[model samples]
Target: MLVFILNAGSSSLKYQLMNPIIKKVFASGICERIGIDGVLKHEYSEDKELKLDIAMPTHKEAIEAVLSTLTSGEGKVIDSINDIEAIGHRAVHGGEEFSASILVNDRVIETMKKLIPLAPLHNPANILGMEICQELMPGKPNVAVFDTAFHQTMPDYAYMYALPYDQYTKHGIRKYGFHGTSHFFVSNEARQMLDRKHNTRIIVCHLGNGSSVSAVHDGKCIDTSMGLTPVQGLMMGTRSGDVGAGALQYMMHQENMTIEEALDIMNKKSGILGISGKSSDLREVLEGMQNGDERCRLAVDMVAYNIKKYVGSYVAALDGVDALCFTGGIGENAALIREKVCAGLDAMGLVLDPVKNNKRSKVARDIATNGSASRIFVIPTNEEYVIANDTFKVVTESR
Candidate 1:
């Protein structure tokens, strides 16, 4: 079946048309700058690409433009809208209500609406995309593939905080790890690469602009670094990860800052940017480090240090990891970060082969030395494929 996957953000909509059964993306592109001056860059194939700059005052117009382009003769990806068997949406926060991807219905939509406070920056855009798809493709099955779904396997102890019991039971505040999709995809790929028969313990480090580490024991998520929100884990491109509560309170009192003001600084101005007082992008930070910038070097060291700490903690959590997989933009491409993270980890049997680690490849492969006890792999994640496959399964099973 042809599944159209949509990952709608505050100002952009990324889409991919794929046949999950065949594992092929027939077409993919993105609609950027929505609600401002919109630009649609659609690629039906490598040789067939289309770019249109037009006004998309609302998400409805953006979706309409995408459909129009997909079916248009000049940039036709599908013969008609009917050719799309199902639509899959990337929902950021499902809270505790959704443990897995489900077919979108009135009840699901309502529950998602109730979750707006949990994912203020993401769920609304996702809901808008789903609602528009429902309107345009009335009877077609629309699936909601949540980013939080895969980590729902986390036990109560791992997900729960040490706060008053009433906070969790009443306010539903607890760890709901983000990037569950990416972690899930990469872990499964790691499992395949390891070629293990019995239950395998895996630690997946998803490093990108936002980073997280997950301990997956036998394909189940036991614990993840991200907690309550995406900002609680590793030091990210901008988000301050794992800041002390006392420090925040101190800042508020000292600066006479409101909660919102303090959070704006934590979520936007902190991390590598705050540390280096330079570009948040790792590429630039690496450049600055090469130029003898102490702050940039510190930023890189902090990131590597945090990741190494998580790896050590998760190793204990998993009792001993069988394989370690690195994914996401930084994880897959930044060899220096990987090398730094793996440094001194030889005691844990994760000995990175410098030659293998330095080599870049599109496919998933091990970077561990031949004699290492634990395997280390670089697996590129495919979240869209996971969404498409989940959507296909849900839709097919419903029928």
Candidate 2:
């Protein structure tokens, strides 16, 4: 079955056409800068990059352009829209409404509309993309694979906040962790790679520009780093991460800043950028550190320290963790980050093997020292594939 997976954002849409039954990806691409002069980048397995500068004035235009690319004769992936069996979408927030991936129906669409306020920045884009897909491919089945769905397994205590009970009950105010898809994918992958049982105690770190860590106890998400919003947890590329509530009030009083302005400062102008007064990219931070930049070094240390602290906390949360699995851009590729994060973890019986750590293998492999009680692994994440698989299951099972 050919599944078209979409991850639509406010200004961009990413798509992948894959035949999962046969393990083949025919084409994948992204459309950038919607609602203005935009760029469409499409790449087929055997062809050079296809770049087009056009006016993608709306999500509808973006979808139309993607359809055109898929059907075009010049190294196109599919012969016709009929070849696309189903569509899978990456919906960032499902709130407390969706516990698992669901088939897109009128009710699902309605639920998504109701969830707009909770995920103001994501749900609308997700709904718009879903609407366009339905409009263009009238009868095809589409599945909504939520980023928050996998985290539904979290216990009440883990997801609740310190706010008043009435406030939480009146308004949906609590932690709804993001990156559930990546965490779910990587944890399962780690278990499979280790030949362990499905129920394994593991911590899956999805460390990227937007990062989070999930503590999976026996294949269920007992806890995670991101909370309420993506702005919580570890310091990210641009997000400030866990700041005290008092600081916000203090800043407001000192600067006469509105809540919105304060949010913008915390979410966009902070994290590595806030601390180093430099670029938010980890590579750049590492480069500056190598060049004897103290601020950059401090930024790197802060991130590693935060992650290390989370690891220690999660170890206590799970009592004793079986393994630690790293995924996402920085987790999978950056040996230095991994090394630093695990530097002092020897007390916990987790030590990195320098040789294995330096190899840079893309596949899942253990990088822990011989005598360590806990295993360490680097697993590449395939969130889109997870979405597509869920799409296939939901679509076929429904029929």
Candidate 3:
């Protein structure tokens, strides 16, 4: 089935028109700066793409532009927009309400609205995209594949914070891990590489600008690095992961800043950017490190150390790991980062082969050597594929 996958951010909307069954992308692009001046970048084929400056004041106009381009211009991939069978919207926070992907309807929309407080930066845009799609293509099937859905299997003890019980009951405050789809996809792929064994312990390190690690036991997520939000786990590009509450409070008092101001710093000014006092992009940090910048080197060490600590804790949580998999942009490309994460874990059965780790490949490949106790792999994540496949399944079954 041809599925349209939509992931709407605050000012950007990304989408892919693809066939879920065949694992083929018909076309894909992103609409940038929705509330400001708009730019539509459409990739119609492997070698051809079009970037046009357009005026899109809202998500509605963005979708319209996408549909118009897809059927009538240089970006055309299909005869008509109607050829797209289903729409899959990436909902960021389900907040304990949805454990699986479901066809979008009034109730699902309302539930997502209630979850906005949990994911203020994500759910609103997601809902806007879904509502706009529904309005544009009336009666068309829309499925919401939530980022939090796959982590719902986490036990209450694993997700609950040690705050007042009423805080959770009345305010819905808890550790709702993000990046569930990526964790689920990569872990399952790692399992398949491990001969489709049962009772397998897999640790997935999804290292990107925003990173997270998950402990998947027997194909289910038992624990993850991210907690409550994307900023709670491993050090990310800008997010200050797992900082002490008292430290933030003390800094706020010293600086006489508002709660929002302090949180903004943690979310947007910390991590590699805050530490190195350099660019947020990891590539830039690496460049500075090679040039003998101590701050940049420190930033690299901090990120690697945080990820290593999380991996160790999750290994204990899963008792023992059978496979350790890396995915996402940084995890897939940064050989130095991967080597640092697994540098001293030979006893834990994660012996990294420098040759295999450095070589680039599009397909899944293992980096652990023959003498290693467990397997270590670099598996590229496919959250869009999961979204498209789920949308196809729900829509097909509904009929």
Candidate 4:
């Protein structure tokens, strides 16, 4: 079956057309600047790419342009929209309502609407994409693949915050981890690479602009670093992670700022950006560090240190880890970051081979010393494939 996977942001839409069984993406592209001047980049194959600047005043127009590009005569990927058997959407926050991918229906849409407060930055766009797809393709199956679903397996103790019981029960405020889809994909890939049984314990560090760590036991998430929101875990591109509540209150009072203004600072003006007073991109930070910038050096050190701290804590939580997997943008490409994270982890049985760590490859490969007890691997993540596969399964089972 051909699955069209979509990840819709507030102003952009990323799409991939793929067949889950063959693990092949027939076409992929992104629509950028949906509300203003728009650009649609369509890549049908490795050598064939088309960039078009068009007017996309809304998501519906963006979707229409994408469909036109896919079916256009000169560079067509499909003859008709009918070629797409199902649509898979990436929903950021499922809360506790969705534990797995499910077919989208009226009830699902309503529930997702009710969840808008939980994912103010994501769910509305996701719902808009789904609603547009339903209008354009009336009878085709649409599936919701949530980013929070995989972390739903986390134990209550691990997910609950230290807030009052009434706050949790009445306000639905608790640690709901993000990046669950990426963690799930990478951990399963690690299991395949290690040839391990179902119960193999693995700690997956998904490092990117947005980062999180998960301890997977027997293919289920036991604990994760991200809590309540994506901003609670690792220091990210622009987010201040794990700031003390008292500090926040003091800052708000000192600046005579409201709660929303303080939160805006924490969410958008902090992390590496606030520390280094530089670009949020890790590449830029690394370049600055190499040029003897103290703040950049400190930023890099802090990121690695934060990741290493989480690794140690997760190791203790899991009792012992069988394999440690690294994924996401920073995890897969930033060898220096990986090396720094594993530098002092020798006592935890993770010994990184410097030579292997330096040699980067697209495929999964171990970077651990030959005799290390905990094998270390670098596995790239494929969230689109996971969404497509889940969509196919849900659609097929429903039929």
Candidate 4 residue lDDT tens string, 1-399: 999999999999999999999999989999999999999998887679888998999999999898888888555889999999999999999999999999999999999999899889899999999999999989999999999999999999998988899989987899889888888998998888889857688999999888899999988999998887788988988898889999999999999999989989988999988888897888999999999999999999999999989999999998888889999999999999999999988889999999999997999999999989889999999999999999999999999
Candidate 2 deviant stretches above 4 angstroms: none
Report per-prediction Cα RMSD to one decimal: 1.1, 1.1, 0.8, 0.9
Model 1, TM vs. native: 0.98
Candidate 2, residues 271-353: lDDT per residue as tens digits? 98888888989999999999999999999999999998999899889887779988899999889999999998988878899
- Residue 32 in model 3: shift from native, Å? 0.7
Q: Candidate 3, residues 1-399: lDDT per residue as tens digits?
A: 889999999999999998989999988999999989999999988778999999999989999999998899788889987898899999999988999999999999999999898889999999999999999998889999999888888888898999999999999888888899999899889888998769899999999989999899989988888887788998999999999999999999999999999989999999999999998899999999999999999999999999999999988999998999999999999999999999999988889999999999988999999889999999999999999999999999999
User: After superposition, which runs of candidate 4 have C-alpha atoms over 4 Å from their true positions?
Assistant: none
**Native-to-model Cα distance after best TM-score fit, residue 91 in candidate 2, in Å:** 0.6
lDDT tens readout by residue for model 1, 16-72: 999999998878899999989999998877668888997898988988888888887
Give the best candidate by lDDT: 1
Q: Which one wins by TM-score: 1 or 3?
A: 3
Point out the higher-scoring one by lDDT: 1 or 2. Answer: 1
Q: Candidates' TM-scores?
A: 0.98, 0.98, 0.99, 0.99
